[model samples]
Target: MTKLQAEVRSNSVAKGKDAMVTEDELDNLAYLKAVVKETLRLHMPAPLLVPHLSMADCDIEGYTIPSGTRTIINAWALARDPSYWENAEEFMPERFMDGGSAAAIDYKGSDFLLLPFGTGRRICPGITFAISTIEIMLANLVYLFNWELPVELAEKGIDMTESFGVTVHRAEKLLLVPIVPQD
Candidate 1:
């Protein structure tokens, strides 16, 4: 979070603002976008996407699938696949920074390597709406205050264990203290 705040502050200063994140600024904030991307990659809201059915019998690797087979694509596994990502278990937003190899990949469903929103015709219809809203909300939250876990909690570290079912989320509530900047 400190890195993200510093990045935003530097951008704002470059644009002649002391420290502010406007909707316009959010549009071009490469680091912010990377953060969001990394978040999605690490913790996809829906780890298991809608099940897809095979139209016809097919051979995948050495396994043969009969026609009309129900297949559930594990998007979470794909995003964290070691073959496609470096330090896959770690949260490194820099992996998606502009000009980086993963920068060209997106959640729009086209990139199988990172399909948080699925892909093809069955892709989430609300992708644009959701992404825009997420960017705005996250930008505002990150820009408005500095946040940290309570000292005791910080020492223990955050519990990143996920409770996977309908959707994937932290196993425990994340308690944090938001320190608002004084005017």
Candidate 2:
């Protein structure tokens, strides 16, 4: 967490004091982008993408798919597959950074192994907007404030148990104390 804070702060300093963090600055936030990518990989906004119908007969890894079959793509499983990710279950953003094992992967749908957004012609139209919004919001949060676990949670650590739904969320709501960083 401290490392992530450092990354955001380091980039934020270049904007000078009192300048609003904007989308234009996102390009400089490589680590933040990697963190967002890793988060999407681990906890996809929609774990089960909308069902895609097979337009024609197709063979995938020897399995014959008859035309018109509704196929559900499990994005969560794809991200956890050891074949595609190193330390797949761990929350490590470095994997998406340059020179990391899965550096080339992206949520843009071209990469089958990390499709946070569904692929091909049916890919989500809001993908670019969503990614940009998240990155900017996250960058601002890290740049403007220092966050810490609530005192009650400091000793016990975070409970990451997730509750399944249309989308997944932590079973226990996260509690944080955000203090504006003093210069």
Candidate 3:
């Protein structure tokens, strides 16, 4: 296990909770989970899901569809729809705080609002492992490092431009300085 995993486990154990995650604990870690969910939402590794051919004719919205029609769901637009989220352009993780909203909904069922790993039986097989790894890594990084913008960059403010290709990356790479903690 990673250091962050150990720390989270230790903290939970110290509080008399089980070492492994419980449903209630998952519920309580809403904010942390929201951050991960939002990141996945905004930066979906695959912007579009694999095309699916309809088995039969269907009507979606006001549009009528024919049988065997190839359909591709745009994960990117769904993540940033203003109808579902306030300040959809901003990276506010707290948008998911309400249990009734898309941010708070569980991923196990037919969750169409946010499908970073896709949905249904065709969803990525590594979803569980990926989520756990990211959570542990983020927890460890935040716990261990004090990140700061450099003097020059801080003066000018950080640039938020993105470069899109096979995968998205910052047009300018993150240059924050990490200050190691004194033990």
TM-score of each: 0.88, 0.92, 0.73
Candidate 2: C-alpha lDDT? 0.86
- Candidate 3: 10-residue stretch with minimal lDDT: 13-22
55-102 in candidate 1: lDDT tens per residue?
899999989999999999999999999988988989888888766768
Prediction RMSDs, each to the true structure: 2.7, 1.7, 5.7
Q: Global lDDT for candidate 3?
A: 0.67
Lowest lDDT sum, 10 consecutive residues, model 1, at 12-21
Clashes of each: 0, 0, 0
Stretches of candidate 1 off by over 4 Å are 13-20
lDDT of 3 at 22: 38
Which candidate has the top score in TM-score?
2
Model 3 residue 56 distance off true place after TM-score fit, in angstroms:
3.0
How far out, in Å, is residue 69 in model 3?
2.8
Candidate 2 residue lDDT tens string, 1-183? 678778777766455667667788789888999999999998887888888889999999999999999999998998899876788899999999999998998777888898888899989899889999999998888887788899989999889888997678889988889987777
Residue-by-residue lDDT tens digits, candidate 3, 1-183? 133344444444343222244334443455667778777777777767667788898988989899989888887888788987777788766666684356545545366777777787788888878887777666555455666789889988779787876456678988888776553
